[model samples]
Target: MKVVETIKAVRNEVIAAKQTGFSIGFVPTMGYLHEGHVSLIEAARKDHDFVVLSIFVNPLQFGPNEDLDRYPRDFQRDEKIAQKAGVDVIFYPSVHEMYPTNMPMSIHVTSGVDVLCGSSRPGHFDGVATVVMKLLQIVQPNEAYFGQKDAQQLAIIMNMVEAFNVPVNIHGCPTVREEDGLAKSSRNVYLTNEDRAEAPFLYEALKEGANLILSGETRRSVILAELENRLGTGSGRIDYVDVLRYPSLEQSEQLSGKVILAVAYFYKNARLIDNYIVDIQEGEK
Candidate 1:
């Protein structure tokens, strides 16, 4: 339950914990802690001896016109939540601590950046990958936890860690949802009551799409069309509905291997994303 604000401070704590033979678990988040975040921290607590939670809202992750300033901030509130969730050290750093200067190089995956949330947000996943890379390096945990709700993000980090051969294990924990099946998110607070009612349909459509593929209806167009239509029933504008090879995030006419059914919907105050990943064997179910 220690909150330290510099990279050195976190490293000192992490090194001390490791010297005591405690395995570290890391959860990197932009503030506004929620049920989704708690799920990841709980997963880490279940497996690791020590947990480090970093709460810097990365400026690089926000787009130029994307309301970076107005995103949200309440360290006092988040600190209470993190301690309750069993975090051992909270790495709360400033933008300067993370960036220091314009980054000399950025981690960008060529394949996954062209679709889903990455397509609209441009350099968003690059920012995500970069920041996660920084945190993973800074914290140097035995395992790091991420929610599967950001399936594309999970995939990106998974790919990056593999390519770069980062030592930590990346765990894509299951997406936690509401009683009515909506994927829990920090952005859920912004949804108008009308948008909230319709938001659960995103998860429903994902479930339905997975069912369709499993039932021998494997055409990509049909699946995407069904999801777009289902969620776009005049509720919010449909950003994209995609079925892609998972982890790689590449598209193909015929689905195989790990596949993810993903969507992003634009409500009045929030743009929400959700997905369902299944290991698809086209003929054998």
Candidate 2:
């Protein structure tokens, strides 16, 4: 696999690939590669003629008090994983290379930015949208792959693409989880042994909430309360547990259409999030 650190070089390569009629698939990540990230790359490899994986820890997407400085990263390890997953190019740009001097303006998907992780983190999704927009513009891939693990992020990116008329297909892959049921995340490395043991409860709680809704419960309050109660036993603090309409991500009061059951919490010093979607059955009023 070829690794290019400069935007000019990467863009030139992409341009050349496009001239050859290669459909590029892009996967933007912050390094610290794991099965979750690999899953995204693998999916992109299968669908596109050329795959580009970016490994820049976007400072804009991280809050001031967040784990930006300590966020896990190992480029050598990540490159190997990407190559094994059939990645054609790895864009390992530095912060300076991305931002440069006098980098003005940012992109924000206003609607979905005020809820869930967006509301909690403050400017998190704006950073996300901005960086993603930049990447989309720079890479100019035919399609981009994102994991459903960041359900809100996925929603916000799709919203930005639609609202801004960016011409790239956004594909959301299934959430990859650990053997113990904890959704895989780069932040999972921050968890203490005890915290790791308790982390799986987040998914368990989300599953229980979906089960409650599927078993004929329509009261949003009751479903959320039950999920909170279940997650309370974990060592971390529960940030939020919400059920919302699938792609739009508006809060849902009933299990109709594509509904998502999502949760976020803190384990040790790391913040984690997970979600699942359930299609309401027909004639289930």
Best by lDDT: 1
Per-residue lDDT tens digits of candidate 1, residues 147-218?
A: 989988888999899989999999988989999999988888888888898788888888988988888776
Whole-model lDDT, model 1: 0.88
Q: What is the number of backbone collisions in each predicted candidate, taken in the order shown?
A: 0, 0
For model 2, the run of ten residues with the poorest summed lDDT = 276-285
Candidate 1, superposed: residue stretches over 4 Å from native: 282-285
161-209: candidate 2 lDDT, tens digit per residue: 9999999999999999999899998888888988898788888888888
Q: Give model 1's TM-score versus the native structure.
A: 0.96
Candidates' C-alpha lDDT: 0.88, 0.87
